[model samples]
Target: MNQPEILQLFRVEEKRSKSSLRQLFAVVWAQLKMMLAYKSWLVMDLLSTLASVVMYYFVGLQVDPHQLSRSGWGTSYLAFSLVGVATSNYLWACLTRLSHSIQHEIRGGTLETIAVTPINMLMFFIGLTARGYLVSLIYLVGVFTVGVYGLGAKLSFTPQSLFVFIILFVLMLVSNQALGLVAAGIIMVYKRGDPLVFILAAVNEFLAGVLYPLELLKRFPALQVLSMLFPYTYALDGMRRVLILGASVFDVNVLTDILVLGVFSMLLVPLGLKMLGWGYDRIRREGTTSSY
Candidate 1:
């Protein structure tokens, strides 16, 4: 290509990049403003977190710590349950945020605008969720603090444990984000709520050991097999090992969880994008983009 042509192309690319950035910032700012406007939720968020910690702490006092230790879930029942509750809550927020965002946009009659806008849809979703997840993250930190300090729950904060926790947490988010994409696509086409969100929540709560030991599921052979179908099972197990046992991601037991999440992300993410595009195009083709 000629030097002038290359320079013109570079200028066009620069403008496009700037425009995309502007679009992203606008979405993030709008969400932030809404959060600031409805400030009552901020107070409720921390208050509810504290309540959960206190409730669980008392409940933990009634449980036999040795039964928990036998399952390798640590002797402190409070920490075990807090990690599960916090992980499940944060993950649920991440997993449903996208579909909820879509439903809100549809109600506001902005789905059509999003469909036609010349913006990066991926970045659009990222911008859509960034602010909300930031708040959820802050809530998670509070839950951990109250559980560890206020309620006397035990947690190991070694570098190895932190590394595994970070890996599991990120993988957990990535894998769940795909489910959110699929759920959002379903909402877009059906003009209804995402059943997948609730279905997964129910499954995770019962089978992922969010508040119980996975070893206890052995009594129900069929349910034990069913639990293996969900990635949260591994993620939660890995998290418990990291937080309670201070295990590294590279450790044999934890490595299995890492691999499971890695595979889930590799498969689900691409499939989710394709599914969302198909669903969105189908809705737009039917002239129902804003018909929530």
Candidate 2:
């Protein structure tokens, strides 16, 4: 190539090197250093997760097979609970991780320092939790594998089912992450966050039917109505239909679940980002951005 062409190529490559995505990846790598610092964490996490799966499997044995079919879900309570255990990690990965990241900055008195950087704080905050979400995705796949191979939990793997699942999974990430941004914002302002996060995570899992069928909520009309308010309710229900029942995208129930989840993602994501920005500003104004 000519000298001019080589210099132009260099310039283009330099610009691309500084692109937002590359910056985000750089930040993710940095965040991973902290996450991987505790070398045994992954092992402990795997062991605990396996123990929980085994425990729930035995629990499923005690549940009458008729009870699941009567509820209009699948016949295997083991399969049902395994799905719940797998998908429910998203709640913590999304909500708790973001909040904890903010608090970590606060505890270290670096929140304000980082906030002042030319870096995009909003994107940076989201990037900080990227590793956690990635880890959660791994767990989700791991549990699904364990369910299929280790425990013989029946799951549908047809193209139609997987397509619907991929769509719902994206919607679930976006919709559920909306509240996580808001929770991180709350932590930014309060310097305390886990109590609120804990309450929401617990209640969200329960309302979303993470461990039980939504049919049980029929007994509590008020709670049934409340359950419909969370995006994860639609997500979990849709996921179950596709994964456990091998439902098609054309199925009315699956369509509704995907539709509702998409709507939730559209409405909540922007609102959550706005709330996070608001909280970040509030802390700065109060001179408490780095105070824990």
Candidate 3:
């Protein structure tokens, strides 16, 4: 192609990209506005986050810091626990909380309206994920602060490490959101909302290494294998490597974890989308947009 022609094509592509981004931001903004409408619920969510920090603080006091640090962690017990707590809260927000939004719509018979919207379903779903991300960030900040002031843990502050940490954290978020989408698919098909959430929460409590190392599960090979598949397991460990252990991405086992999370997100997102579409079609065929 001639230079002029190529330039024109580039201009057109840029404009389209800008327009797509604008639309995505608009959708995200609308979802945030809807979330804000539930002011009391938002406050309660914040309080719950703060409560987690307080609970962890007291629990830390009961454990001997020397014993926790003696286990070759290099950091104080509070520092180690804070990373686990923050990442765990993010996992809960992304997976357990976000999974229920679509189910609520289905139960209220409003999911049909969503299917009819011209907005891209993928964009809409991801936009909704921002609410959970923001809520999780609130909790992370609270717990992290508690680790610093309430528990007297020193943080290693380096710009490069911070950037790498945030990137990995966001990738972990995407992976959890993908799992949430899968949970949403089950809700779409079976209309059963609470079971997956409960099961996942219980499993994470023991297996995600929130309070202990995964090596502690050696006696339970089946549980160990299952826990290895959870994105939160890697995320919690990676966060500790960055935030507490002062390890760079090159020094840490981040690549393997990132690869696993990437694969999960790439595979499950499409499957979940297809399943949700099928559920929407079924409801439309029955003319039950607003019917439970």
Candidate 4:
């Protein structure tokens, strides 16, 4: 082949390789545009985040610092609760956004059309959920910033600690995606709200230590056992230790958390995919793919 012809061929191949990424970006951009169209909701979301920070700050103040340290987190209650709050936001996004997106597509009569497209179905759902996950990360950062500056919450992070924190955060996201897929699958087949999502949310709030330390749950063995089943319990605890306590990834407890989260991701990802495919097939067969 001529030099110019070879160059042209390579360009085409590059474009083909990037097609999936382009599609993913398109999905995220569409969601962002839709969100921006409702300027009021965006503003209200920010205000609500601020309100949460204020409420949590005051509540944390009521808890003695000595008692917070005694809980084994080695930080003030405000700082510890900040991490829990931030992590829980991502969990909420995962639990609701994927299922809601599917419901929205069905009610809008676009589910069938999209299902017929050549793009990967899993990637499409991932892209849809990615927008909400990104927004939740923004909310997390905003809340933490407000806590540090406005609420007098101390957040100390060295470069090493920050690196460990990012690794754990990514693992948490992958682990949470499994739960999102299961929720999405439930929504697809049922064509109605999934009670599991609400149940999980309540369980996470009360049992997963979003607002308090899981150490308290140790007193109640049943509740502690239930909390252990949800990966967020470990995630929030590990994150607080690494970020606030300056623990290393190799620390015994931190390493255990990583191993557990990694195992959950490996097991759940395939199971989630299988369940989603089964659910989609059932809906298609029942002629309800586009039904709300």
Candidate 4, superposed: residue stretches over 4 Å from native: 1-18
lDDT of 3 by residue, 103-129 (tens): 666677666776675656667666666
lDDT string, candidate 1, 63-161, tens digits: 898898998877888989988888887677766787888788888998779768677776787788876687878778988999888877889888778
Question: What lDDT score belongs to each candidate, Candidate 1 first?
Answer: 0.82, 0.85, 0.71, 0.83
lDDT of 2: 0.85
User: Global CA lDDT of candidate 4, please?
Assistant: 0.83
lDDT of 4 at 279: 84
- How would you encode candidate 2's per-residue C-alpha lDDT over 57-121 as one tens digit per residue? 88988998898899987789888888789988987788788888788878887777877766777
**Is candidate 1 or 3 superior in lDDT?**
1
RMSD of each: 6.4, 6.1, 8.8, 6.6
Q: Per-prediction TM-score, please?
A: 0.90, 0.91, 0.81, 0.90
The candidate, 3 or 4, that scores higher on TM-score is 4
Model 3 CA deviation exceeding 4 Å by range: 1-23, 286-288
lDDT score at residue 24, model 3, on the 0-100 scale:
73
Best by TM-score: 2
Tell me how far the alpha carbon of residue 213 in candidate 3 is from the true structure, in angstroms, after superposition: 2.4
